[model samples]
Target chain A: MIIARVTGTVVATAKEPKLEGMKMLLLQPTDASGQTAKGSPVVAIDAVGAGLHDLVLYAAGSSARQTEITKDKPVDAVVMAIVDLIENQGGISYRKG
Target chain B: MIIARVTGTVVATAKEPKLEGMKMLLLQPTDASGQTAKGSPVVAIDAVGAGLHDLVLYAAGSSARQTEITKDKPVDAVVMAIVDLIENQGGISYRKG
Candidate 1:
């Protein structure tokens, strides 16, 4: 799993049939502190109700397909959890607002 | 899936019991040209007979567990194919030496 922030949403009219009616969001990988960018941005299926600017944990690859909604889908990334808080080295690094 | 180069090997005397007898290799992600570093290095199970310095394609997350040898294993990455050549825009970008 990777920590990322929901930056935006994607509206695709023509996509894999399995992905029909699924919500896709743009994710920007974030560091442990959830304050800085860690890697490139990726598009992921929304399993959790993640809103814009929300910190989330997403699973990549086939694990992304393990969810009930994404099962057997051609998607490669999925938002599995909405992060509430992050603690680093015994101190709070980020708290959802 | 991602393209990477087999950089080295990992030797662990004690690891997850399910990972017993598995060969772990260090992989460095590469660009489509197979000549530039793309991302951080990762450790992946060797599903194919990959050797040091070999360009390969690897599956991440649960997809890594789809192989016959890695099925149901506690692994997140697997080298699934050894690249022979990489063609970019109708041109050969990389060829095995």
Candidate 2:
């Protein structure tokens, strides 16, 4: 899984039926320090009800569909977990609360 | 799906039983021009019969398990298609044959 931040939202009126009620969020991949990663942001299906700026754990490719909400959907990325904290290299890299 | 080139192979004798007999390949993500992508090479399970240096389409996330061979497995990435060509901007960006 990749650590990312829910930067924003996306509303696609025209999409596959399987994605009808799924929430799409703009995700900015983040390093352990919670800084923006190098790659361009990706649009991911929100499965864990993460809010804007919330740190999240997202899965890409086929793994994105493993969630019950995204099963059989054509979605390629999904926010699977809401991260509360991240400790890296014995240092507090990030914390939500 | 992301486009990638199979670079090498991996042999893991100890793994989940569901992964028995599955082929693992090292993949280098590629651009439309077939150039190496920025991220580090990833280890992916081959769902299709792709060869070394073969350009392939891979799905990551839960979708990786959607295939018959990977269903219920802990795999995170799968090579799903062999690419014949990649045409971009009205130009032939890549071709296999």
Candidate 3:
């Protein structure tokens, strides 16, 4: 899972039905500090209740399909968890309330 | 899971026989000594045994359909797990063996 920030949402009317209720958000893969680390923007399937500016953990590939909502969909990068904290070897690198 | 490399390979004849023996390379999502931190090439779906340059661990949406060859198909990113080491705190930034 990579940390990211939700910038906005996308609506594709022609997408597969399995992707209907799912939220597609524009994400900037970030570090623990919630800053862009890769790519200008990416489309992600949101799950972590990620608001417009919330830090989130997004899962990709088949794992994104693990949810009951995205079964067999052509979706990638689903917000699996909201990053409440990140403690690598660096002390208290990030935290969320 | 992040860290992988497999510089070439992709064959698409017709379509969807569940990706038709599914060997789509030209994928270059790498890290941990293989270079390219963010982008340049992002067509993963290889596994741990990835040849032509190892170091891999890729997984994206729908869990890549949690496959015995992507059961539900429509794979996002496969190649899960292949990092030998990744120590932080600015000590041993990355490693593979």
TM-scores of chain B alone in all candidate structures, in the order given: 0.96, 0.94, 0.34
lDDT string for model 1 (A26-81, tens) is 99988655688877999999876788998776667776666678878998887766
Residue B52, model 2: Cα distance from true site in angstroms: 0.8
- Positional deviation of residue B55's Cα in model 1 after best superposition, in angstroms: 30
lDDT of 3 by residue, A1-97 (tens): 4557778888889977667778888888765456546656788876546678766655575666655566678876676555555443234545665
Instruction: Give candidates' CA RMSD values in order.
Output: 9.9, 9.1, 11.8
Give chain A TM for each model in order: 0.96, 0.95, 0.84
Q: Report RMSD for candidate 3.
A: 11.8
Q: 2 or 3, which is superior by TM-score?
A: 2
Clash totals for all candidate models:
0, 13, 23
Q: State in Å the error of residue B18, model 1.
A: 22
lDDT of 2 by residue, B1-97 (tens): 5667789999999888888999999998876556657467999888667889887766677767766777789988877666666544345667674
Per-residue lDDT value at A71 in model 3: 61
For model 1, what is the C-alpha lDDT against the true structure? Answer: 0.76
DockQ of 3: 0.09
TM-score of each: 0.54, 0.55, 0.52
For every prediction, compared with the true complex, DockQ reads 0.06, 0.09, 0.09
Q: With candidate 3 superimposed using the best TM-score fit, by how many Å does residue B71's alpha carbon deviate from the native?
A: 14
